[model samples]
Target chain A: MNPEKVNLEQKLSRFDEHWSPKVVGELNGQHVKLVKLLGEFVWHHHDEEDELFLVVGGRFRMEYRDREEWIEPGEFVVVPRGVEHRPVAEEEAHVMLFEPASTVNTGSAGGGMTVADLDRI
Target chain B: MNPEKVNLEQKLSRFDEHWSPKVVGELNGQHVKLVKLLGEFVWHHHDEEDELFLVVGGRFRMEYRDREEWIEPGEFVVVPRGVEHRPVAEEEAHVMLFEPASTVNTGSAGGGMTVADLDRI
Candidate 1:
């Protein structure tokens, strides 16, 4: 087994595209992904998987059905399964996502923003 | 459902004890824990669960069976199940752990450093 250390900053630097998630690491059937966000993401809900969003840089507002939460650097927000939410960022935001390997970016509301093939950074 | 944002820095500030882990959040049956580590830790290995060590502050060296890996801030190391490892920190190090809710601090080598009841920050 390769016990290499995964550097978040280095992996994040490898990509520059927004909304496209690049896999940084994997453990226990979960994929740790790095993504750049700008503007607004589509409202979607995952029926069977919860998603964790950890802000690496910048800030973003996560809008839920009943309320909105601001996630800044070093902060994280967990969107539970089956809950509708949208992430909006004024500036470029770097985020690390932890979820099951089978989880899709657009969830059940898959459309053009849906990324089927994620590149491993 | 409480869709609260977890501030890692704030959660880490709430505890100062070394080797003790405080839960910050939970998702998909896994607990996100913040722990302060100082000095050397006991060598142990989980029989059935893999562990993720994400360095939030300071630095530490993870001693594995064959080699030692130095983990610094913004770097993460994953220890696979049943792999013998020990974590050592020259100075105070803050880390965020992601593992199953039932994961024990001491793993199979339970001793005085073993913490059973982890406080939720």
Candidate 2:
């Protein structure tokens, strides 16, 4: 009752940086984040967390060690813990990520795109 | 990588039961469920689990003791644990719910509408 409703489109419009996830909602010790993705991300794996990527706009490609899948809008793919993966977007893609509050964007493969400190919108 | 991609619309089409939630995906000890709602739901509260309701198609309403909010497509609302709430949908509304695997559709308010054993889609 206290928390307000969140609109995905309105939340997506507040940021533009690629791979930078902004926390939009939190529940059950998990943070629901919104990230605008473009190009290819660093290959990484969350040693302690499983990440759920739901495409809100455009398309997202989840590349695993064995295969890759294209996730269109309204579709989601879950990358389980300890599984190496990378996300690639041909164009600007709006993604909603669900994971623990401690999850990092780059995961174990920290790089320039690593967002250690995320801001809640 | 072991988990498959889930399409919201495709999953919603598999069931037509009202107030009954079907699990579509699971991650990090949580379950992603889809339920179609019509009319009003029982007032209930989850003592230990927070519930997130994300509207995928049509519209929904989250009614609390004091106020209520209309949730349209692309909108979501998080009802914290122990907060009494009820969902109302004048028309058929497709919703995606994210909560712990132990969550029951009726919460603490058990009745004929309570679905204890949910089927996975």
Candidate 3:
């Protein structure tokens, strides 16, 4: 397979769905995804893998069961495996997420928030 | 472990070495590292894993055995497993790299470019 090369701006132009992640690249057995988010995401956690949320642009807030924190552009937070957390944004936020190749955005929640299949960009 | 939350700006400030990558974060069993590079890096390849080069702040050029590519800020290129390649930048460039937790910066090449150990920020 020819290796895929993508730019943040280029990937951002390919999709408009909020909360749903579009796969940008893959390294080893992990996937890199970009998501445009607004409002709030359901509280969920991946039972077997850690999730990384890297804010590419705009502000992001992640609220955990016991604490909440704010992340800005260039900052990132890793939600440990099996930790329930919700992500919310005051406005449209562009972010990159890193997780295992088979991880679901909503993890085991399987709700409206769960994206059925991963879209490759 | 209080899951570490680091901004790219904060991590960049803690190290000034060129070519040597400082580990910023880890997800699953992989590590995320930041490196400031100038001039050229030796031709090398990881026999067991693919490597990701995300240009965080400058331009990068990677030359492979038969092909080459240029990447700019906000852009990323993945060098596939076992592809011998060399990375070079005319001016100082800042980038973030993703690889397996134990993969060295220089892969199997044990040289000065091979950082002794991953430095956690």
Candidate 4:
């Protein structure tokens, strides 16, 4: 089997759209996605799947019901299932999200930010 | 719920042992581990779980049965289940491994490098 190496920086350079996640790799039942986040995202929660957010570049603030956590480069946070949270980035931030393949971008709060069909970069 | 942020660099700084994986975070049924790799690892393959290797710093070469793939910083390679592979790093490399919690470090070709109990950093 030919194991292809996925360069995150190169894959990230292929896209400039914010909030739209592009699949970079897959393992087991999970999909590794790269997204450029800016401004604020909708407050939502995954009812059945946990989401892993890793900051590849820049910084983002993860706002929960109680407090806000700043995720800087080389930092990661795991939002467990059913936990309401929102991500806000003051500037363009490169992020890597690891979750189940079936996970939606908007979670329960589907809106314009919802990406039903994700692009692979 | 308090979402604690896991800093990869800070966690990696807590340990310097090579090949021994330290758990940094957990998502679903998988464990996100950080390991420092130097020199060559033993040839091995996981029978029931696929392994995701992301190079956090430096570079490493993945030697497969037929060819070798160089993984540099910000690059990742997923070794599918049951595929034979050996990771070789000429210099010290920082890497993050994502796989099932039960994944053995040495896979089927277990030897002294096999870590039955992983430490959480």
What lDDT is reached at residue B9 by model 2?
87
Candidate order by lDDT, decreasing, is 4, 1, 2, 3
Candidate 2 lands at a TM-score of 0.98
Alpha carbon lDDT at B65, candidate 2: 93
Ranking by DockQ: 4, 2, 1, 3
Candidate 4 chain B: 10-residue stretch with minimal lDDT: B1-10
Model 1 lDDT, residue B15, Cα? 75
TM-score of each: 0.97, 0.98, 0.96, 0.98
Tell me the tens digit of each residue's lDDT in model 4 across B1-121.
5779999889988988899999998888999999999999999999999899999999999999999999999999999998999999999999999998889999999999998999997
Task: Choose 2 or 3, whichever is better by DockQ.
Answer: 2
TM-score of model number 3, chain B: 0.93
- Cα miss at A95, model 1 (Å)? 0.4
Error of 3 at A74 (Å): 0.6
Docking class of 4: high
By lDDT, the best candidate is 4
lDDT scores in order: 0.92, 0.91, 0.87, 0.93
The segments of candidate 1 whose C-alpha lies over 4 angstroms from its true place after superposition are: none
Evaluate residue B54 in candidate 2 and report its C-alpha lDDT on the 0 to 100 scale: 93
DockQ of 2: 0.84
Q: Write the per-residue lDDT of candidate 3 for residues A1-121, one digit (tens) a residue.
A: 4455688998899988899999898888899999999999988878999999889888888888878888898888888898898899999999998889889888878788888788988
Interface RMSD of each: 1.1, 1.0, 1.6, 0.7
User: Which digits, one per residue and each the tens of the lDDT, describe model 3 over residues B1-121?
Assistant: 3355678988898988899898898888998899998999998888998898888887978888777788888888888888888899989899998888878788877787788677888
| Model 4 spans with C-alpha error above 4 angstroms | none
TM-score between candidate 3 and the true structure: 0.96
